[model samples]
Target: MARVKQKGGLIGCGFFAHNHLHAWQEIEGAEIVALCDRDEKRLKEAGEKFGIANLYTDAAKMLASEKLDFVDIATTVATHRPLVELAAKAGVAVICQKPFAETLSDAQAMVDACKTADVPLMVHENFRWQSPIRAVRAVLDAGTLGDIFWGRVSFRSAYDVFSGQPYLATEERFIIQDLGIHILDIARFLFGDVAQLSATTRRVNPAIRGEDVATILLDHETGATSICDCSYATQQPEELFPQTLVEIDGSKGTLRLGANYQMIVHADGQTQTLDVSPKLHAWARRPWHNIQESVFNIERHWTDCLNSGHEPETSGADNLKTMALVFAAYESAAADQKAIDVRRMA
Candidate 1:
């Protein structure tokens, strides 16, 4: 693939950085010229794995030394604001991982910084880009699911997220911030802006500091109601029910995405099933590999936006609504399921 006019760098070479590295290599008109991490060991290891010779322990040093058009921050939630602000200030476009920030104000600040710098900032909220989810969005856009009034986006699994990223277990916000944010963002993406939100959160695992399970009810401006549930304690059979499923009911039809990327649509007096799972890759052999592969689609989108001067799907300003939804869920849970106004939160 030919390189784009603009070359990019990657900050924070952690568990998810490998996905970004692979995706960038696969995309045309994009090249990762440098990689940075706080830990020299991790930085060196990632550079070697990806064949990137330019490595730095300090992001500021990397940004100063490398002439990059963009930077992807794959670091933890705590580091997002500072890294994004730094990149924007350096006149580099940014692709940040979720949750956009630890708080709404910080998220807003990051977005504002990018806007002030006239550089693009996109949140890597990739759930909506999953093949099955994208297919569902296509169906809705085609008016097959006419005027959806009720919907449910659910993710439940016993997978141990704490093993690889234990920091998630100690965070003040749990599933709602870490996992539910993706589901909530998907709802907002497929539906529209939320009007109100009510939620409940519980720390199902005593070992974890924050809530490991959460359920949120949303009222969208389009009069569509959505229920979003995320949990790390769900003990369902992974074979029959693989964590992510969405059920949408419309005035005239219904669409359901079942386990293992199965899409079932009931409309026009007939039923149809669409296999929308992503194509298999060598690195994506595990059961939960799709989640990692979806990041590639998002990275490709980012590169395309940079090349064509278009906005990515998950722009920072657009993702502020998603961040607000996460905060609203936390506020609603604290208020004992009292509905929180989305507009007032802003």
Candidate 2:
């Protein structure tokens, strides 16, 4: 028997919500039937652009009226807890943007809400879903990398992101909350959860309210060490704006993922290089295609899991570990590079 399309409503039609909407359009078994936002102008624009007529300026009204199977919350951190709880109370699944909450407590509340309601919740943590990153994970899982001991996940670029999301520059917590969260999650995906970690942060860009650069050292529970770093102040001739370069050293050999989605794996006395760049979807643009494709992939995974009675890879409960790392990085940075146990989020 063919299943009916799962009706989904999207909340917050801001900057990155367009990517979610575009990706949702490509996902099978899912249809965004409604839109919600406080900004009337943005709501009208997105409704017309996406051809979604069921729109609301208030989420409560939309939740009360729309019979949605899921709601994708693309709003900012400040609105995350309430929106997630609202969806949970309405008995709809939720997919929320990263930096899931401003604090660990708020993140916990949102996760708890979905658990209590017996609904699925996925954090929009899409970095690990990026194809190139998945390729590296495949090699590691195949034992081709052989007992990984050390690794580095880095994303450094000077792209003018503030032009689109101007509020990032004014946030008390910037890079770690904004960009480093992805890098840290990737480290967890490639390696494992952290036992302890320390970090150092810098505000190289005078214009931003928070630190624009950060370097973190993580001790994975699998007896591996990894470095996760991010910067918006880096300047290079070849600006790899959106690419995350990776290097991992294992008992057998080393693996390197460089610019242009090139991967070199040297193992078993042999070396091989492969191009792992993501395919550009019809609606996706370059540099962002990798990210956009991951959005589609994860969303499809969400619907599949929702149907199969399986939990998503980045489920709210699972993302709690990733969320802990984000908070630990900040605590370490503020404590003058003191090592912090990942278990103690405070």
Candidate 3:
């Protein structure tokens, strides 16, 4: 049976939104019917490029006028709550970008709005959708890793992220808030809900306002401990920019996701090496192809969930736990890296 394509309206035609637009074009169950942005030039450029004639400079106007099934809020953190509430008010589902809100209260409000309106709300937490990450999860699920006790999710690189998104350099919160949120979420995805968290952050790059280095320790509810470390200040020989390297140790053996998307697993007296690189989409380029592919994967998942009337894996309510970890990390860092009880905070 051919399902009717779900109508989607995308807000914020900014730097990262291009990937959303490109991925939407490839989605069979959904299509972005309208585009909105305060910047007229970017809006028109996106509309013309994507052949989306229904365009608006105001999101409210777009929501009131277009009969969309869902609104994809790809804007920055500050605007998420209002946009999400607006979408919910219009009786439409929402897919909000990460760093869900400036605070957990606002995120809860948005989640409540969607629940009140009987609409599905998903957060665009795409790191877990990455192919290599999924492959790593597959090993854990296979139980070959066996009673995972310790792990590390590391994304250390000297990549100049500010080159494409200059606003990142000016923000008071950097690596942890922007990039580490994804890494932390990945930690929760691979392990489980964190019980306690402690973090130490430092501003190694004098050029940026926020810390470019952060190492967070997590105590999972499953009695497992893991470290989520990120550093944009670290310069490596091969430069594993935009790549998340993971290592997990269990009762049986260990699994490692190294540079170049290589995965090595050892268990039961056997070791297997495999390449778990993401497929390079037609519109994607090197280095960014993995992220771009994950964008498509997650968007497709959103449509699937909508069609099946099932909740998304990274729904608003589920993401609150991830958001809790983000806030807890900052709280821990500020309190001299004190270990925080995550469940109490959440």
Candidate 4:
């Protein structure tokens, strides 16, 4: 018997949604049958570019009418709850963009709605799905690095992000909510669930409304400690816009992922360097290729999980833990570097 293709509808056709559209085009078992965006001009532009004729201005209208297996909500954080609830009521799976919610209560409600509907819910957090990060996890799993004790996941760039997403500059919270979510998730992915967290933040870029710098310390349940730091104010001779540099120390060895996708593992007096760069898909451009590839990887993961009836790695339930860290970091920073117990957030 041949496998069935899952027909999905995409909402919010602005900026980053383009990547989602392109990624869905290449996914084998999925097809985007409909698109909905509040902005008529953007909807028309994206519909024309992707040759998608099924477009709507209202998401409720799309869900009420289209026979969809899933709905991908690419809208901003404020709209997540209502859109997710709408999808849940429609009995369709949902994949939401991160940061998942403005508040933990909303996050819990969205998760509960999906649970009540018995439909899959995934947050489109693509950082860990980045090939280099996957390679790092492979190294850890293979025991080449032995029992991992400490790690650092860092993303610092002075690249002009506001040029594309101008709205980001005006948001109340910047790096942590936007970029740090991914880095913190990477820390969780490598080090395990966090038991406690401490953080500090500062707004270095006067041009933006939120902090451009954040440093968070995580004490993992696995008895490992890790640091997740991000800065949009750091400038270097070579700009690593979308690169996430990682360093890990273990019982037996150490691992380092440097700029230009160079990954190195050192153990037992031996060292290996490999290029873990992401492949440039036909529609992908430079600098953004890594993130673009991850968009594709995560969408494929969603389809595979949807088809197999398996929970996604970043499922709504699992993302709650990651989402906790995000809230904890901000709370910690606000309380003057107080250590926060992750459990107390609920």
Please, what is the whole-model Cα lDDT of each candidate in the order they appear? 0.88, 0.93, 0.95, 0.95
Query: What are the per-model C-alpha RMSD values against the true structure?
Result: 1.5, 1.0, 0.7, 0.8
lDDT of 3 by residue, 1-346 (tens): 7889999999999999999999999999999999999999999999999999999999999998999999999999999998999999999999999989888899899999999999999999999999999999999998998899999999999998999999899999999889999999999999999999999999999988998999999999999999999999998889988999999999999999999999999999999999999999999988999999999999999999999999999999999999999999999999999999999867
Between candidates 1 and 4, the lDDT winner: 4
User: What is the TM-score of each predicted model, taking all chains together?
Assistant: 0.97, 0.98, 0.99, 0.99
Q: Model 4, which residues run further than 4 Å from truth?
A: none
For residues 127-148, write the lDDT of model 4, one tens digit per residue.
9999999999999999998888
For candidate 1, the per-residue lDDT at 325 reads: 93
If ranked by TM-score, best first, what sequence of candidates would result?
Answer: 3, 4, 2, 1
Candidate 1 C-alpha error for residue 125, in Å: 0.9
lDDT of 1 by residue, 47-93 (tens): 99989999998889999999999999999988999999999999999
**Ten contiguous residues with the weakest lDDT in model 1:** 235-244
Candidate 2 regions exceeding 4 Å error are none
State model 3's lDDT: 0.95
Any runs in candidate 1 off by more than 4 Å, and if so which?
1-5, 239-243
lDDT score of residue 200 within candidate 2: 98
Error of 3 at 125 (Å): 0.3
Q: Write the per-residue lDDT of candidate 2 for residues 1-346, one digit (tens) a residue.
A: 8888889999999999999999989887999999999999999999999999999999999989989999999999899999999999998899998989878889889989999999999998999999999999999989998899999999999998899999999999899999999999999999988899999999999988999999999999999999999999999899898999999999999999999999999998999999999989999987789889988888888889888989999998888899899889899999999999996662
lDDT of 2 at 116: 95
lDDT of 2 at 214: 98
